[model samples]
Target chain A: MSSNSSFPKNEISIIRGKCLVLPGNDIDTDRIIPARFLKCVSFTNLGGQVFADDRSELKGAHPFDQKQNYGASILVVNDNFGCGSSREHAPQALMRWGIRALIGQSFAEIFYSNCLSLGIPCATGSEHLIKDLQKTIEADKSQVWELNLKHENIKSSENTFNLTLETGPLKMLLTGKWDATSQLISQKKNIEKTKKSIPYLSNFDITN
Target chain B: MSKGTLYDKVWDIHRVADLPGGSAQLFIGLHLIHEVTSPQAFAALEEKNLPVICPERTVATVDHIVPTISQKRPFNDPLAEEMLSTLETNCAKHKIKLFGIGSGSQGIVHVIAPELGLTQPGMTIACGDSHTSTHGAFGAIAFGIGTSQVRDVLASQSLAMNKLKVRRIWFDGQLKSGVYAKDLILHVIRSLGVKGGVGYAYEFAGPAIKKLSMEERMTICNMAIEGGARCGYINPDQTTYNYIQGLPHAPNFEDWTKAINWWQTLASDTSAIFDDEVTFDASQIAPTVTWGITPAQGIGINECIPTSESLETNERLLAEEAFSYMDLKPGKLISGIPVDVCFIGSCTNGRLSDLRAAAAVAQGRHVANGIKAFVVPGSERVARAAEKEGIDRIFLEAGFEWREPGCSMCLAMNPDKLIGRQISASSSNRNFKGRQGSAHGRTLLMSPAMVAAAAIEGKVTDVRKMLGSIK
Candidate 1:
């Protein structure tokens, strides 16, 4: 079973095929989903608008408009991926576009967190590795690339790459330990117990 | 034997108790809120039947979802109207100060804080919005919190949190001509990467930082989140005191002297201890732009789109996607890439100064043939100030729409949006895919001047080239 992790994770979804890669830095949220569709309060229904501006600019020739990659999920990108404002919508739009995982050298703090919360895995590697994977895929889109989520590896014919994950967030996502918040919640007893020790925090009934 | 750093001093002063879980029950001196994320928190308060324990310690405003154009009654978006009404009602009910549209004091949460002197040295501030860290520019410890925590603040005026390690980022040398605080921050984020500041509060120090104007400091701290820092701050100095001197919320004459002395004492000692330290050269920074999905994914104006070969394995796929979506080939210079729209406004760069900078460039020129561009002020006051200087006319004449104040197109909570993959040069923060309100809408983040240059060229062009011509 594939684990859902949002923080840059070594465990990646192994897509046993070459995926189309895009190369732009600072590809902002607007290009992922246009503002016109943001009026909807729900992230689930904004799927069609993913890459709204980019799709329109391509005049139906964009890959997002094509039916071939409808459910294709992997997205490889440049450094500072998801930079700009702290809107969680950027990742929400991408997740809806069926982008299950993002491969990039870096990610915006907010965007990366949002992706993690949504079970979307983002991985980071060196610039050289990113470029090699891109060239290999650009030369042969038909070749399947493997992004092994459990193994923390990206396997291509030419090279295999290992990645690092921040321990705190990784543990939370790997075992459905979406329980960190719950742990915080359960700390109510501990909080109360400590209230006696620290009269200031307890004076206000800080416990939830 | 250690001279405490600003972070260390502030953290120690605010630390109420160190709990068993290693988190500190830091005493919050001030908390700010806005309509977007507070409704739910207020509702949570209602559910708990809690009263605002310290209404005087909190401030509220409406920025997000407020239409920049015609912020009239019953906003065009029904939900926005509801949010406004709810915030208005909530503030009234809680006795918390609410800065509504048209109030002279009503501005971006971050902007109003400094301008009114509500943010002061050594205070710990928290807001529901991430950019709340903007207040840290004053040497205050600030954090952006979640909704439940918002409820906690409303109920107790304090939050339970862990102390963060402090990283001292020292910028040496003076910034060169044409370089502004925006460029400096972009440079910092680019060098540190977005996550470099994680688990730390960045104390921006050294000669270069000390010389910056308060507004410039705000801009530097504004993007602290980009560097993955919980907050970025400079010790409050004469510049900070001068900026806050006569504001409505500032300490009056008698209190002013006392406040200044207190503020002076808050500066980090010469021998401050820091968990970590990073250094950068001021001269090395250049006019930067985000070429891909993230703020960290940036390149110098003349740099080329990264090819897969230059990136890591995980980045390869995104690079390929960026190349295709942005319709740029690898190694192609980003400077001449055609842009379809130019947007300026957001908490990031929607102040009066940002508007003037962009307007100066747009004054005698028109937006390029096929480009769509506009300026949205961060607040009503900002819009009015821009109009007072006729910056609005310059933008209008230059083919950019002059919208009212609010967080527009920046996150597309309102009508402004990219229709379909329209490449834009935006001055607002964040360039994540679809961040500007369209799923595939391409966004390039740059300083307001850079956005102006791109608007004129219909592509990403260097602002320095046209700086002289614009003036």
Candidate 2:
């Protein structure tokens, strides 16, 4: 493994942690971070409040509230997780809560993109494999899980599941091309040229 | 050259470049920013020492956190004031146009954009708000992006996006009276599960859609995101052209005809292919209401709450969760469910037409004694128009408090909210748990007219039953 000090700032090709299995499908953005908490000026300190209402309602029974899952960095969920609202806070709250990667049956498109933008890799596996992996993690909470993005495999001490990521986002994660802002800045000259060609944009002046 | 669908034409015209991956960089034609999602994005741009590349393409408005009761300087909620001031500072720094409170144009971003004619056929609109899809009513490709994506748009006037498959949702028959556009969309979302449109852009079509007013079309498109679509659009026609002809920001007379011709070409060719299609009979739709948390978990007002057996195996768990959260009993009739609050406003149903519909219902009837009712306009212009039409007086006479324009009681960012476990008949979008401020507060989503009916009856009453009296 590469030294921690040498970790790339823009891409994550691998992640290792004890997996925390959240047993539910369509675990929407509102549950990930309640609308109440979204009023904050910044995303900072949102880690502590991720799943705040759900955890409270469950009375410490939520997987994330359990002591064994405290530092778990990989989150495994059922199909269609983060399915409602285009709230980026959902992924931001998860990332801040120490989740470095997500493996599930599937994820909502916007949520997947938000996670990818943050250099967090979200992968998928068949329902059977995902459920089996969740069971393995639950039976022994201490088992370390490793997600190898380059090889498309997720492994635990007793099991290995084949994982798949969309080719577009996978390439973006591997090559650090997910940072669209930087890419946009680099192509400024071309954008300026485009702006000049569009009559509506070229003729737009604040004075007018 | 291949004849393209509306989505393809818009996508191709806006595409800046193909990125390293299978994503395309799309130049945004308009960027609408609001108080809630823009602060962090502006801060990020500041950190990167980046200026807004094309400030003219971006427009700023304060909506989410602004209090509807009193929108004076130094807002009662310090956080709300700070958010507004931050937007003011950012817009001033970047030379971006801002419709701050008291500006005649100030309103919900989605509502004001169309009213100002900033949303047009064949344009690509991006906003840091979920209801950005509301603009797609004008035949534009609109996206609701996250704050980071907002920063990307502000810094480069473009966004990197993977193309979406197109799905044509065609309505086969005319809507029955009392079945509003809100009901039509609610029916669509319920029939097609919440996750059905995950990777698609929906094209709303058929004779029923073409017959809708621009405002009604906007109401339908506003909740396209609720059905999990990336965006939704309607092909421009005479109705679209007529609506944009006189708007201040629309193309002048010299370019108007040319613009209309180009917009007409953006519609799907007769032989255009679609990845998927769904057809709905609009005649069957009634005034709809969400009994559970999700927008999809809705039924006709007269229908009973869905039984577990009626739900798919995977949806059962969420249904149970919603049942518990909403304090609703499975298989119980959705009608006569007592409502403690009646809220008539949101980006989804706070436009002028929505206000007129609600006012029509409230003309002579008084709100029930125990029900707390309020009517909020979507924009300052809407508020003014309502006042001019005596619609505000009708609401006031009906005992519904008429308030200033903003996103009030929608997400409950401001002072207006449901007190503890109060069930609300809300004209807003989204019925997610605690979405209306109180952790236990419950919202039942419906049309503005339905909400007005609920206020008068003090329960879930059919808008159709009250329509005869109003007429």
Candidate 3:
């Protein structure tokens, strides 16, 4: 879990893993990575610290601590998963802890964007659909599953489920343009032009 | 699809390019940075060999990690010191204005930005902290970003962002005397659920919103993230102009009228159309308090926590989880719950107005026996102002430890934290487990005045009972 995967700065349309189920709703970023652990200059050691508070409180009974869920890189969670704070540390921790994608009832906006930037596709599904998927994984922890953002579906050998994501983000994941700094930087001319047009940016001077 | 709303106008105004992914590259008019989230972003920029394209637009501050009890040269906590030093080194290297500790303007980024008038209307502001929405009190469209986006902003001065749908939250009437903006926001979250504002920029409008002071408006917008709205804003008015008029970064006298005219035009037109509209009656809101980890799980001071069977099927699981995590029984009254600690600070409610409201409550009252109660101003300016008004003296006399300015006990990144399972009556925003430092620590979110009242009682007490109509 501590190994840094060479960030494949390319299309992440497909994510394969054994689904790990974490039940309950509004599972905030604080629970994902508690604020106490966020006192670092780097996110390198965050993998071992993800769910530090919850896992410690559960005393080895938490899903992340369970042996059956090992190698589970696709997390199955309930509603409002990753709901508090804008700490990218939450998604970075999950990514470093072996999660490649997330399927939840919903996700907080900032947390979702953080995951997208990290190339972790957060797919959403209907309540019934997500619960069914979570139960399926719980009943058979070893079953391998694959989420295809290109086709917008999650599939195991025996089952396939539909998931929903915004088209704009879908395009980003499919086009490997999720890493957006280059794209933004590439529009240097427009950036300057836009900055010049903003009144406050130029101290309200439009002429100069 | 929203038309003529501030969010729409600001988004269009800042659009630099139509990104291929259907997202727009929008220029960040004001880029705010803080110690906790910017370090990694700076590291990424160095790793990528990129230069900060618009260093002038970015303003740095040290808040999330600084100790509220001490403002020494190097922080006592080694890791906290390292984090702050990393920010100092990065800001120095980038030539961004670092409002380091003791830079009279240093405080919570959200607090200082607005206080110094760096936050203005018709701007698209972005910061790495979720409470960045606090700047929206000036009618600016602001949002919280992650470290990667922070890096993106550093490299390009912009973000590839999808324009958010606008939801005008119309408030009718005025907030009752005892109720404040914090109560209103908590009540809204409680009614709407924590995820209600996802993908939507909340437009806090109508008569109730208009009547609030700019600082009060900031408190309401500050917790927009708590309800899943990355951005929440109030349109600028004369109140906004008055607040920014004399501040350090406000437009100069020559540009004041021009700035006001431009700000006036940015408000939502009378014929504006929104993606959705939700209305609330301000008079209906009470001194709301959270009884659960998520901000949405709140009840009016007089209300009892609902049993699982009483909630909707979708809300039941979280309700059960809340009951256990908070160690409270179903149908228990939220008021009268004993608290071991009381904290009054955070980006959400640490402004001078918040302290004044709390100080008004603590004027002649003493904190309950054995309660560890403290007050931390949002910024040095707020601290100085409170001291000038003898508000700090009032708190100290009432047995509340008046401390320095920082985001203390809110996220608990510094040493100011709770000891084991201690439930705090906090004026901070989030009430999440371990949020105030201890792994099992509990937090009951309320108005600062309510936190003051709770400090007096060593339990969750309704501020309305103690209020002699301060407003």
Candidate 4:
């Protein structure tokens, strides 16, 4: 979304929402938000263009375009989601489109970090478990899914799937340290100290 | 402590602190910024009232939105003009050096850095662009960060990042003529798959890599991000030093010896251990081209498009999708595919040497009728060098548009784009769907010489065969 919205900055221990399953692997950033839509000065209104080409091509056949999945807050996808281009628009578009959490077999390193910075936890599960969850969610669009980060598990009516997140991101999401700028600012003194030690930095005239 | 890899040594030296989590606060030695990703970052800084902690450490340029054909002031596209003006304003406000239009040093962020000697060995470079790994050619630990991370770097001159596992990608022997660094990286990606390098920093080493020129090494590391590595680098050596010796921003003559001595120690120790090791024979690689959406879905120029049966179960669906999207038949030979456009530019292959290689192929030949071909230099300096060497005249005589420096058609942020379903043989990186500005445009990624050959034939012809014909 706009990122300036009053979304909670921390306390992402648990989340409950409808899951929209998008079956595909290596769904790159280009597909998440096509390059054409990346020309805007700001990321606002990107939700409408999320999967713009795919949705137009599929003509409402894509899960995201379907009426039943209109307000889905969680997305379940196959392996290696968000694989190309380091466009932050991918996660921004998804977040604007109402996705608050993502569960997939894997995610591109940069994409995962971008999502985490927005307080969106990208958890991973085994293929079978993810597929089963996707199928179950597809069968009933209204089914509620519970993602418990504290316990590292996702539960639907019929099954509970184990999800895993790296400890670094997990802590960042939990404590709102996801905003590295804040932490960096708090450590300004230390950073300055280190900056002075770098020979190249000393070459620059740093007034701050 | 035991010996460490180049990545380890660089990481250890730049690491400012180990954060509460397992991540490290890494001091960024050079921060390169372009028009597209920095506007939001500067906006964030403005919103927070944070002055750029170290403006001298950061350099700005306008690339993605600058039109290669007509880069005159007040671009036809209002948005492009706005982006450029915004960058100029931000850089002026923060006192960051910007290589704007007409600045001889201005070019794609990746291309200008090394040539200016702003990119150095053992440095930690960060840019708000994914291809920032291109600087790793100098043995630097480089990373591509998002706009927010760009903001983080601007505010603190550091980035909080998780340490990546080191992977040694050893290649032996010598690359055959006509096989370039693009092919080698394509071969590596094809073998490892796109996601194989996730959570790792690839250290490209061995006899083959040692033989490549600095620009060629940059080409190899440029696409490392395409294979899912956060970054990729080669060990700096005498070649690296020679490239840096007298450049504008390089160490002065008095400091040169001391700088060389320090850089020599930045390479990985012979006994350094890695988290993973993979090897390939240079002889095994050939002139390669990507037929599918991802860089990993490539085949040798002489090879055929793979059928679903030939792919792993997980790869079949995407392959099938690619077949349909590209309007290509499975098992069809990649060489004979007709091309409508041939582009030689972008940070991946728009260097001076790339232009020279393409110019050699286009010396007496002309672009095929009805096929559009163009060459955009990686930077203004590259363009000037090509012009001085008469490479631009050769390309122009060959009926290719010799254009200004900018990231043209690479992501197609400007007006240069493939209209309709025209298939392109492009030297630029990424063959993603609609990556060349047309929703249905198809891109076949290849080397500049191969693109030159493809332009002449209006088909995906092998450069080696064309070389013989030219001789």
In terms of TM-score, the best-performing candidate is 3
* lDDT tens digits by residue: candidate 1, B145-228: 645566667776655564677888899998876667888888888778667786678889989999988777888888888777
DockQ of each: 0.14, 0.44, 0.73, 0.48
Pick the winner on DockQ between candidates 1 and 2: 2
The best-first sequence of candidates by lDDT reads 3, 4, 2, 1
Off by over 4 Å in 3: A3-5, A203-208, B469-471
lDDT of each residue in A102-195, candidate 3, tens digit only: 9988888999999989888899998899999888888899999989988889999999999998899889989999999999989999998888
- Each prediction's total of clashing residue pairs, residues at least 3 apart in sequence or on different chains, is 106, 0, 0, 1
Q: Candidate 2, residues B1-471: lDDT per residue as tens digits?
A: 223789998887777888886788888999999887888999999899989988988999988888888898999888788888989999999999999889899999988999998889878899987788899999999978888999999999999898899999999889988889999999999999778888899899998998999999999889888888879899889999999988989987777766776777789988989999899999889899999988999999889999999988878988998998898899999989999999998899999999999988898999999999999899998999989999999999999999999898888878987888999999999898878888789999999999999999999999898887324
lDDT of each: 0.72, 0.87, 0.90, 0.88
**Segments in model 1 whose C-alpha atoms lie over 4 Å from true places:** A1-208, B1-3, B312-314, B469-471
Answer with 2 or 4, whichever has the higher DockQ. Answer: 4
Output the chain A TM-score of model 2: 0.89
> How many clashes does the backbone of model 1 have?
106
Q: Write the per-residue lDDT of candidate 4 for residues B1-471, one digit (tens) a residue.
A: 224898888777677887876788988989999888888889988999999988988998888888988889999999888888989999999999999999888999999999999999978999988899999999999989888898899998898898888899999998998899999999999999999999999899999999999999999999999999989999999999999988999977766776777787889999899999999999888899999999999999889999999999988999999999999999999988999999999999999999999999999999999999999999999999999999999999999999999999999889889998999999988998888988889999999999999999999998998787323
True contacts kept of each: 0.20, 0.46, 0.88, 0.49
Give the lDDT of residue B315 in candidate 1. 59
State every prediction's TM-score relative to the real structure. 0.75, 0.96, 0.98, 0.97
| DockQ top scorer | 3
Q: What is the C-alpha lDDT profile of model 3 across B1-471, one tens digit per residue?
A: 899888888888889999898888999999999999999999999999999988888999999889888789777889999998999999999999999888898999999999988999988899999999988899998999999999999999999898888999999999988899999999999988789999899999999999999999999999988889999999999999999999998999999887887888889999999999999999888999999878998999999988999999888878888899899888989889999999998999999999999998999999999999999999999999999999999999999999988999998888899888889999999988888889888999999999999999999988888886532
